[model samples]
Target: MVSVASPVRQSESRGSIEPILAVTAPDMKRVNDLILAMAGSNVALIPEIAEHLIASGGKRLRPMLTIASAIACGYTGEAHVKLAASVEFMHTATLLHDDVVDESDLRRGSKTARTIWGNQASVLVGDFLLGQAFKMMVEVGSLTALAILSSASAVIAEGEVWQLSAAKRMTTSEADYLAVIDAKTAALFAAAAEVGPVVAGSPEPVRAAMRDYGRSLGLAFQLVDDALDYGGSAADLGKNTGDDFREGKLTLPVILAYQAGNDEERAFWQGAMEGGRNDDAALLRATALMRRHGTLEATIERARHYGEKAREAAASLPRSPSREALLSVVDFCIDRVS
Candidate 1:
């Protein structure tokens, strides 16, 4: 197996999300309760499938972002809780849909909802959660928040479709890959953070700062994940290593390796990405190429670039524990590969 270690390290506690969790604890409790309540349905299968994924050990970082942004902006209202829950529902809905699209078998170290409940059921339950999310958004009664999230939902769908089209295409550029991730992954994060300021009635500059922070953080988070697929353990990944390779997904590591490769190496990557070489040996060779070309490290460096951007954006926010926690999350995301 290919194992590459990250050069960056911090104190174990410094890299933990304990601060974010601590800052958002009370709000998160409400968010969790609302999630359980909203996920319930007359159709028992709906709750079963939804809860299967909802309770599947996700850190709920998106929702936490919503809560933290609001608190950091000095909002003292209950709407943030509703908005936080709504963010989580949107995230869960996307997870269900993504697993179906990716044909993924595992999520967060457990059987995917589709694996347990089947694709049709998973899709329908995802639809149900999305519906519930809109309902909560409506209850919160912020047109700005509603618009931000609704627009993000549409952007996310577009990103997924764009990624599907880009899949297995060897010519996919970094810009093209970045466009897909900006929509699929970062859009919701941007919306999740922006909605906090909207609910708090913070000024537009503050809103923009939080949104930028989230966007940069999301980009960094995904790059780290892509790097980890090649260099980290399955236990660290919460799924099998090289799942992206097996699925022929075009991520930054693969893109960089392909660009840096010699003709023989290019042929190897082309065959691998075209779905003709998905065996264990191919995965080893894929990682071997990535390591040899320093693509994994390059990818992590790219992530750190975005992590720095996220920190810069967070720096504009008011000084508070919540803000510091948000900054620490950037560190946590980039340092995970170590």
Candidate 2:
């Protein structure tokens, strides 16, 4: 269990985890330089903004997944580096847009792009990243890579729309929430894991296994994220806890709490759902209600379930150091507090 000890200091952010494959230190440096080169820019107006956000130091999880999956699949080509960079570009684009949509001021304990710059700049730079990602993909020159990324982008957009529309609507079910998360969060993860083998022409069964692995891991990751927003500290979470409550977003814990609460508890949450940041008291009460009704435990249990499935999905990949690393990463995902 994570100790509820002192106030959570920002440890080295999770995104800084070393790459799973046992690349020599020098080889890993080359990959890092390649990511920088791919993320760098020629555009005069927007390049700085892109660089600022790109350099914000995400763990590069998606790109790492692509690279790890490729290595596990016995890929020998240099294209994986470019493709992994493309994945990171796509993910960064989504974060820029998500911050704007959520009106979030902080990311990784720093001012978000929308807060540091403006929504307009953030959105426009996000577009630049999208364009850059496609350009990088073109350099890869494979129809399969294009297809994987293009479809994942479409699904992510659709998922965001679904969540935006569904927010605060009492009729939204667990299925509805799952659908939104699957689209917005899981699709890219699935693409990130699958693209490696697809690019390398791995056998069909192996490709499917990798896709399943990514899908399960993505679901687990988001579930843990949702849980942290309710139960985690601001220091640990890098933002205020209860943003979802203030914004009226009904994530899994709240959904389960809502379902489990009595009429009075339900009325309390309904009132809080429409309120804003000042409803910190209500958020704490709602969290208590979740604890009372066992929703927090349920959410954690579900995250663990998905993590197990993700590990299972990884089992069919051909044995390799990369495969073991991927499994260890799966173990780490459910362990995260924020």
Candidate 3:
């Protein structure tokens, strides 16, 4: 297995996102109130399912990014709150859809809405949340922000479809995987952060900087998630440890291992990824191969590269508590594996 003694342990004290939380707490409260209010519908199941996932203990990182970016850009208007809530709604909707698509049972240590409500209900409720998200964006009245987020929604959907195509395909390249994540994950992060500067009416350069920061941060975040799937436990992921392997998904570690494996090992990988030989024994063997090849460590190193890019982008913004907090978030994303 990959060593549990991650390099992230070197700076454990700097990994907390508390600074951003402290700076954005007041705004987050307003955003939370708006989220709850908008989530309400006469159809009881709508709110029930939405609230289940919303209140399920996710860090609300996307919305917080929006709020922090706006504040960092000197936005004093209420528009950022609406945009932040919109970003969160978009994220929540994606999660509900993802659980159904992945046939997942758990999220953030709670039963997924799909498990309790059924796939049809989960999908429709996700649609409802998307509608609510668009409504909030329209309420914000920033055409630029609306366009950015609307485009992100399309890109996220496309990314999901792309991931489905890549699933169980061992031939997937590193570039292909990066493209999948850039569309599915980084698009929202970029939108969430860019919307802040857009609503704040910051210059194009400032908006570009925040967008770059969010994109790089998002790439780092997802790479770590991919690593954790193989290297960490169920509690660390809030789901079963070997879900990726069982699902036949081709994440970074598996890709690297497949590339480095000799014929016998490659055959094992082919059988495993092709929907055969995927029991606990197979998972154990898969993890062992990854450890032998150090793919997990290499994956984390790639994540660190993106983390540094995010930090550099954050450094370009005007200095403030929010800016510093945003910088810290980059480290937190990379260091969480420790």
Candidate 4:
């Protein structure tokens, strides 16, 4: 496994990210405006669903990755705004469809688009946003950029299908879990960071560096999110606690927990994964078992390890405000609550 300098003390606290908020403050309003502008021109009905989902207030991390990577690679193009918005739209589109597949009701403490707008509307609107993303990509007119995003989308689709097929299969391994995350979560993040330099016509090595940096960061980000399902407060993390467990989706934390468990702990997991019958008490019992086995801490340590790797990946970049921003974002990933 790739490692880095001993993990830095987490700079941004979980649940309350004052430091990242400070870094993002300058770009926040403009980025929101750009995202709004991107969503405005969709067909009338689609725009309503799109706005409902977009207005639900994500941290806008994907677009932030795009703009920050562009600036870090020394790009001064205005197109970064549209590129960033395009990335956000793709991400939002995925989330809309994801909620439908997962049957998720609450996201960021609000009713999901599928919950409020119905699944059909949510799914159709998600397709519309995806079309819009491709339209924006064609507008940028970079064959390379189109290739990167197309491959990323393909990987993401594969990951989603893999997860669906792998559910409740005891054959699932850590390798399988990592494969799913790499495809589902890390692919787009890698694209978001790589596309910036591609847009700037950056050197090959620099573009490669940004892609590596974002991939590591994305892995770290997803690890923390999976871990938080058992350990995080719903009020703080902005989702229902232990929702993954309820859905019978095996994440890294659960995989590690199962590996390190004693007979009773293992039995509990077997029961939980059986036919997806996850009672509240059973999930709470499993959470307690995970804590006792230190599985959650081990999962967190792995995430921190990757966060450090992300920082190291970007360390060779020329120092600039964008470099600082990227480093801070690495810190932010491991530290964020949701």
Best by lDDT: 3
For residues 1-338, write the lDDT of model 3, one tens digit per residue: 45534634455465779999999999999999999999999999999999998898988999999999999999999999999999999999999999888999888888999889899999999999999999999998989999999999999999999999998888999999999999999999999999999988899999999999999999999998898998776766767778888888889999999999999999999999985679889989999998888888889889989999999999998889999999989988887688
Per-candidate local distance difference test: 0.90, 0.77, 0.91, 0.79
Rate residue 85 of model 3 by lDDT.
94
Could you tell which candidate, 1 or 4, scores higher by lDDT?
1
Candidate 1's C-alpha runs over 4 A off are 7-14
Candidate with the larger lDDT of 2 and 3? 3
Model 2 residue pairs with clashes: 15-59
lDDT of 4 by residue, 220-255 (tens): 889888877876766545678788889888888678
Per-residue C-alpha lDDT of model 2 across residues 79-138, encoded as one tens digit per residue: 777778788889989999998999998877678888877999899888877887888888
User: What count of clashes does model 4 give?
Assistant: 0
lDDT of 1 by residue, 69-158 (tens): 999999999999999999999999999999999899998899998888899999999999999999999999999999999999999999
- The lDDT-based order of candidates, best leading, equals 3, 1, 4, 2
Query: What lDDT is obtained when candidate 3 is compared to the true structure?
Result: 0.91
